[model samples]
Target: MEKNKAYFVVILIQLIYTGMFLLSKAAFDVGMSTCIFVFYRQAAGTLILVPFAFITEGKDSSPLTFMTFCKIFGLSLLGITTSLNIHGIALKYTSASLAAAASNCLPAITFFMACLMRFESIKLRTSSGIAKFTGIVICMGGAATMAFFKGPELRLLLHHHLLPSHAQLNVAEGSGSGSIWVKGVFLMLLSVSCWGVWIVLQVYNS
Candidate 1:
């Protein structure tokens, strides 16, 4: 039952992320500044989590050292601020689905980073290791496909005709060159890499 609940939570988180990508793209279309969006996002997250951390763990936790504080700050900078800023910029040039597709690389990137940091072991002779390696390879391949292949256009059921004129204009403005798509892909990859680093650091600190 507990395992089932955990799986449900993971699925819920993915749904939330999907919504975030779509909603963020809409926000960008309305001329929201990426930097300002990131600033408020980080601020809000800090406000929420700080109090929760204090309430839940403050009494039980040991005092934080200067080194520990630095690590936590670095993680926040890379994971929250840098990642979200890049994501916002990328969304301006690419579709929400494209951005979400690129994000599928996150787990694979995190796995490799953890291996590099000696936090995860890989034994090629073992079945589990082989499966893990294969899955990572597949994920990387999918990310590459998303980066290079434009594929067929997916028409929405509601259609562009239903959208406001300004929204249509925004969509048209954002649509263009292969170069812009490639740039967005690179930015997303960079953002995911930063997130992967944060994951490794978080594990180390914990």
Candidate 2:
């Protein structure tokens, strides 16, 4: 039952994340500033977590040392502030699908960072290590393929066919500039790298 609940929670989170990508893109279309969006997001997150943290661990938590506070601040900067702000900017210049696809490279980035930090070990002769290595390589390959390859479009008969005039205009407007797309991709990758570093820091701090 616990395992089932965990699986359900994971699925729910994934759905929420997918919805966020779509909704964020729509918000960008309507002229929302990325800075304002990120500010509100972070503020709301803080409001939600503060009460929960106080209620759950108010008295039981140990006193935070200066180093611990610094670590937490660093984590917030890397994982929340920098990552989310850059992600919002990336979404403005790229399609939601492309942004999400680029994010799928995160596990590979995290794995490499973890190994470099000595938090993860890889034994070439061991099957588990070999499997992990292969998985990371495959993930990198898939991310690169998505970034570089634009295959033939699968045009489905939908509302676009019914309203071809409006659809064509919308399509033209939605087509982002190549340079801006490249910048967005770079920013997305940098955000993921920051996230990977945050993960390593969490492991080290733990």
Root mean square deviation (Cα) for candidate 2: 3.5
TM-score per candidate, in order?
0.85, 0.84
| Candidate 2: residue 105 lDDT (0-100) | 81
Which 10 residues in a row give candidate 1 its minimum summed lDDT?
157-166
lDDT of each residue in 106-138, candidate 1, tens digit only: 999999889988999888999999999999999
Q: Cα RMSD to native, each candidate?
A: 2.7, 3.5
Residue 12 local lDDT, model 2: 89
Clashing pairs in 2: none
Off by over 4 Å in 1: 157-176
How badly does each model clash, as a count of residue pairs?
Answer: 0, 0
Predicted structure with the largest TM-score when compared to the true one: 1
Residue range 92-155, candidate 2, lDDT tens digits: 8766777777777888899889988988888879999899889988988887777666566555
